[model samples]
Target: LLWETMILPIIRGNKLDGYVLGTKLCPPEFLPRTTPGSTVKIPNPEYEEWLSNDQLLLGWLYSTMSSDIASQLMQKATSKELWDGAKELSGAQTRSRIVYYKAELQKTKKGGMKMEEYLTTMKAIADNLAMAGNPIPLPDLIVQILSGLDAEYTPIVTLLTDKISVSWIELQTNLLTYESRLEQLHTYQTDGIQANHASAHFATSSTTNRPFTSTNGRGQNRYYNGRGARGRSRGRGGRSSVSSSSSFCSRRIVSASCHLFYKSTTLFHNLGMCPQIMKCRYNWSYIKF
Candidate 1:
């Protein structure tokens, strides 16, 4: 707020206080002519306005500095003197700050941070470097940005570098695009894997509860044949009565007499049958054993 509302306006108005004592001393045009032999001299016509403007600028400069800084510049009568003093006083600090920011840039990395965050930090460091009289070139800045990225971006970086001239803006756009594509690919693969797992589970369950199987003759199957099928119990005279239920195999059995026969029962036994939301009857025997 201070910079925009006060400092910028002051600078733009050409009224920013700075050293001008030397310029003030120089004659503009010619000093008013003095009588030929008389020692009396005429004042420069602009001296009054010059003195007025200088004092006004001087006051603004003094008011803007901190007490500590103001004290050091108190003796500076002109705007230029104050400015030079301030720069000389802050030069060491500025150099140190530049070093700190450069070190941070060198050490910073994307790591788990977002791409935007990393780029923003790098830009800030670059700006500070420029302010410190060490402005980075566009290509060098782009290199620094790429160097700080995570290892995951290596392939993309390689691809981009190989294909086109690398610019910071272009790299940033490509990186974001790549990130979105990776997220989509991961989501697609995850959904596909879940779907396949669900399919396999349904198939296994179907095979396990098959209506009838030769390996387990007239055994306890969830779906029963409509035909009166019989099974021998453990005892010699033991009798097995078959009952039908629509709770299971309701879709596969359209009629009480309908039966299912697979071309490769063994294959189905291992992999199970595909799950169907609706069952349909196909050619098969409703045989009596």
Candidate 2:
């Protein structure tokens, strides 16, 4: 059989065919030429050509193999020997080989491989086993895939394990989706941290550029607005060292020209000290009470 067009276009497109495989070209020592009519064997010519082509084919086959297989077959005497040895070696899916594949599948952790790569690797192993006459059941395949995952995938693993049945395709899709969600969550958290940092930096810069004291004169009153003096004042003149009292004067003290609100009606002209709000016109030490 040759590389089929419909099954694998890539291999067929590469121009490799089963021509060499179907035509068993004998080694140079085994043959030289074929007689046209006589049944008896006769070596006439073309032994050199056969030797060259066989060695060339053998090298080509060796180049296509992995290092392990190539190293094992590197000492074969001819192309046909190498081909037959390779076939015999791979064709035997013995119990030990099956066990080895299963162990390999079990131990293949998803450590740092991305979601797609991890799944592809696992699937490749399963496909190999299937080709070797030991197909793993769907449930076991799903279980093996989940078992190979790290702790970060525990949430999805738990959800799937709790169910009685799950398909491989479904599990694969879910893992990829979960991976995407994890990536998005990480991105959003990073963005939020960056925003908070920027906000803190802006606040610090604004504070550094701000003034600690008022820029107006002590006589300036914020309440003397063009609209009207309607609210509590906010100016240097209104600054006082004392707390606001409940009445015009919380204490009774002598004053010369300041007035006080006594009992809400009586005006004690010379009996109390002036409140900080009052614009006193005289000294309180000379007051007559």
Candidate 3:
């Protein structure tokens, strides 16, 4: 009666140290017998008690270690190698804790820890790092671990795919387009003024000694007089003269044809190679091939 009166208050006050003493006072087999029903159905209360204490101790240890590790990771501002190593260690520790919790949860017949709880904790850590603007480099490793967990516990592939797709988009958007700049240059060159006033004036003025008058009211003298006009007229009238030069016209046509061919080839190559373009296509079977 005295033991009950003294110990009951201690247990009621939630003093686990005193409760341990009380548990020790009872015979080891006493708990299993009082649990009721078949012997095989009874839990090992002592082991459960030890596991509960161990879980508290391990949780504290991991939390303290994680905090220190995270601090160390943040302390080295310029060393990518150090940061990567720290991130790997952090992932390993978190994965180990998850594995431990998963095993413990499986042993329980009722009210076990859920995988969602672990995922929430992992996501919290990852989000915190992301908010800091320097996410961990081992996201692929983390995804692999999460994917394995999903396969064993639940299907989280959709969530993983969503995350990876964002990164893929960012990567693809940063790719350089060489053909685009080349096509712009080609268009600019082909459409630009081929000959200027300086070259035309030199050609006309060199044939005559007369001073010319301005014809366009811009105060600049026109160079072509009667002699210069006759020279230019003869130059334009004959096949051997400047205007009817088949070589120049043929060269221009050849250049234009080459430019068109190159532009078409570039467009076809980019269309076939572009990831966004490749996603749209009818199969050969759909085309009756």
Clashing pairs in 3: none
Looking at model 2, the pairs that clash are none
Among all candidates shown, the one with the greatest lDDT: 2
Per-residue C-alpha lDDT of model 2 across residues 45-130, encoded as one tens digit per residue: 56666666667766776776779878877788776677667776765534556777888898998988898999899888887677
Better of 1 and 2 by TM-score: 1
Quality of model 3 by C-alpha lDDT = 0.39
lDDT of 1 at 151: 78
Segments of candidate 1 deviating more than 4 angstroms:
1-22, 26-49, 63-72, 193-289
Q: What is the alpha-carbon lDDT of model 1 when measured against the actual structure? A: 0.58
**Model 3: residues >4 Å from true position, as ranges?**
1-251, 254-289
TM-score of 1: 0.57
TM-score winner: 1
CA lDDT scores, all candidates in order: 0.58, 0.59, 0.39
TM-score of 2: 0.43
- After TM-score superposition, what is the CA distance of residue 230 in candidate 1 from its true location, in Å? 17
* Pairs in steric clash, model 1: 17-79, 18-79, 18-80, 19-79, 19-80, 19-81
Better of 2 and 3 by lDDT: 2
